[model samples]
Target: MKLARIYNVQFGKRIVTVKPDWLRVKAPQWERVGNVKEILRDLTLNTVCEEASCPNIGECFKAGTATFLIMGPACTRACPYCDIDFEKKPKALDPTEPARLAEAVRRLKLNHVVITSVNRDDLPDGGASQFIRCVEAVRTISPQTTIEVLIPDLCGHWEALELIVQGQPEVLNHNTETVPRLYRRVRPQGNYERTMELLQRSRQIAPWIYTKSGIMVGLGETNEEVRQVMRDLRAVDCDILTIGQYLQPSQKHLKVDDFITPEQFAAWKAFGEELGFLQVVSSPLTRSSYHAEEVRGLMERYPRQKVIN
Candidate 1:
């Protein structure tokens, strides 16, 4: 059930379809977009929406929701696929960041907030303390708001991971952005097994907290490879899965091998659910935290009693 649109581009001698019609997103309204921009500007907060150039920024902003990016905007890892600035030595963690983020949440009147940060490899805790502080501050300022933390792997730092699980966010997401074979090139700092370990161990530590992960297609991965990754995720008891089409940020980044069709995205959703994922959000436009707030509510409706951590 895709829309009627065809995208063809001339790379050199070949005309390639980079994006299909269904992948074309509607323009975001100015008023709602400006309101979100003004709030983040006034509060001095960063959002992954603007940082990552998310396609749904307008729609999400119009709906009065945003995924807040905390810590500094600079990342330690220089993943070519990523657009976040690389800093071998990013600035020291901001003590006031947590409170400021809480203030933004209070003003936005958000019911759910997704707090993500750049990789702070230099820190002893891998920036887990900042995440905890932000969560606590938000609870203090707006207890009604549920929290989700989109975290990095912390380079397999179990102690850091322990602090985060203990913080008890509604969702803990660490994306395995590509397949194992491609990890050497796409995510050289990341390990597929370690990513699995993070999700599996989180469930063990806080069984009540939902574990989630996401991956991008169109990076020279086969359909079978994608399914295998889903199987690996399920083995770790990951509760949620998100699959999306990968768009290259620049010419220096990896080229899009193919644009996955809407039909294929829908099929993956069905297959992942069949394999035991509690829920799956799959589409060309899906990202790690796409429609994050609504996804929480959908899962919460069929409540599972969680063991108090």
Candidate 2:
């Protein structure tokens, strides 16, 4: 099998081997990044930006925005493609976390916030209660801020999903991660059917809360397979979608099978929009929570009235 060549570009004195020119992220203002990091540290908060080794961390932190990672910096599942630490017996849930997260939001004075957690399969509610707590805490401190929870599948605990939906966040996101054909090798513990069911149930339970999911390319998936995943998401009435290129975190993790070009990402964006997604953010550097604040505009554009039961 022929492997794709990694491209190297010299930056002043340093030569870095990045996948493509399109993947290059500009250096962010470190002073601003440090300010955000200092706030997070002072509040004892964790963010997915740092835990996942996301390439856009500089951009996000510098912009004074971050995806608050509650429940832990340690995930229960050991998905090979992910960079988050895997711990079988992580620490007990911190009761102070929610308030601290809210403090961070207040200090940041953000108009929108994204809160996500590691897979806490060890917990009975799959950390759904924690999500509710965080959402409520943020609302208490920053009522003007819209909340988006990028959550786990809850190990198929429908009741827990109901509790979260009842919290009434502005958006509920559970990433499909990859095409169905790649689920076994890519996600291992993740079930494609369950992902679809979770998104479908979120829509059914709370049509007012936007349903969002994301997938990564350059992982040996065919274009048609990616398109089919979009179709599946739309069938479940998922409202927002994000598509991005997968970069190998380290040699220990999954190797990048290909480098998806900018043109390909643009094509996927167009296809997702045509499929009736209220918003489609597709680019080589796009992540599930990248520019997540934009959802505030989406909520205004497509306002959903809460259903009275």
Candidate 3:
């Protein structure tokens, strides 16, 4: 299938660049940097930032924060927008992963930690057990630390969802990368309705847990289409929403439709707040976990802030 050309907005005389300022902050204390690397090396674990080429790595690491990717680096699904390598077959699951993740958190002395994994459809439970184990491990090691998970759809496996929810993470997040019409082109194997179902069911399964979803613009989607996605998420009672500009990962991947202007992002943030999302981060460089610490603070003080359908 041929890709659609992005619509360029012709303004009066000035040409607006779609690229936003790259977000970066200084790394945290020198002592903490060595601590983070030591734990990662000890556990033989990988991080999503390095694996996916995330733009927030510099700032996050400087803040002494990191999101660990469990269940190995190879992904079963070949999503076009993602930079992670896709392997037809993957290595065996490491039973030691949970303990090592927990140890890493303890070593870093993180007040909050984010854990996510690649799609492991090859496993019987879709690596849900590994997620639970990691959460438990973190909780056991650092009882005061807040744990957040950015999860997969589990191929519509409720049993698997239950396993992760049962671990009792503070936040549960999943991304709806683009509008429904573009799903087939961008996330071909992912279903829009199923993604909604997963978010909706998460609320039903764990009413107290904060539920969140995210999207990326510049995917050849229209402004009206972005608004529609926000409404769909609100209908499912999604508590938090993140809107960001999509960056092309490689020459083999999709090209940028158009660089979204920063002003446009600010406008969208206002629109989302008006739509009743408790929290909305609409910036050109914002990713799903960009303001994770702030989100955790809001959710803690206003536990009932999240509206459930």
Candidate 4:
């Protein structure tokens, strides 16, 4: 499917470029890369590494770690900026996905595993059951592994949110993706307030667990708007924040507003730290779950401000 065709474009005299030199990564080499691929394929599992076309897949897979994409390769909402498919009627959830995922984790012997899924709005619980099962399976098979859940807003299902929180994930992340002004065009089915509510509720439900959020630049948002988002995240007691330069997935998706410079990313990092975030990962290739294992450690160094129940 032609999900997007807006990564780059050509002008009369100048060829517009969305990717900068700093965003380029070298080819990954190592035996683990093949091993990781073989396991994922054998089990018929999906990973955001491939689905979202992450630039760091080669590096991450080479290191024997991948962010598993559960539920499906299809999402309920068709966010123009995203690479995932826009399926109004996706296939039913696979009941055995959790077990297969757990087995793969055990086989891969990953110390830190990240589990994320496509939106399942058709389901009453917004696919939280699959998340719970995957978490439990990972705990059972590899008790030592740290499980981080990159979740959605659960389509406003509070009970479903509670279930996932009860699963006791090491890190709970719900990416805001973009600033409030761009929410309608960037994520039409998503609400900025709902995103805030998810992070706030997560912090309240599981004070010990690190709460994280992420955003992408070059979506027609100004620097001040980005700073405002960082402040908003901090207000909810968010511990970790990730900011990356948005590279339009395909030519059909949202057009790149501008290619943000590395210097700008560094400046944002400094500003985010000043806002009280434990760790601010700001770079070109910094996707929501990128280097998640290391980012989660910030919570340990920075204590929570919330009054724990």
What lDDT would each prediction earn against the true structure? 0.87, 0.91, 0.83, 0.86
Better of 2 and 3 by lDDT: 2
Model 2 misplaced stretches (Cα beyond 4 Å): 1-17
TM-score of each: 0.93, 0.95, 0.88, 0.91
What is the C-alpha local distance difference test score of candidate 4?
0.86
Per-residue lDDT of model 1, residues 195-231, tens digit only: 9999999988888888889999888888889999999
What would the C-alpha RMSD of candidate 4 be, to one decimal place?
Answer: 4.5
Which candidate tops lDDT? 2
In TM-score terms, candidate 2 sits at 0.95
Q: Of the pair 2 and 3, which is ahead by TM-score?
A: 2
Instruction: Give the 10-residue window scoring lowest on summed lDDT in candidate 2.
Output: 1-10
Better of 1 and 3 by TM-score: 1
| Poorest lDDT segment (10 consecutive residues) of candidate 3 | 15-24
Considering every candidate listed, which one attains the maximal TM-score? 2
List pairs with backbone clashes in candidate 1.
none
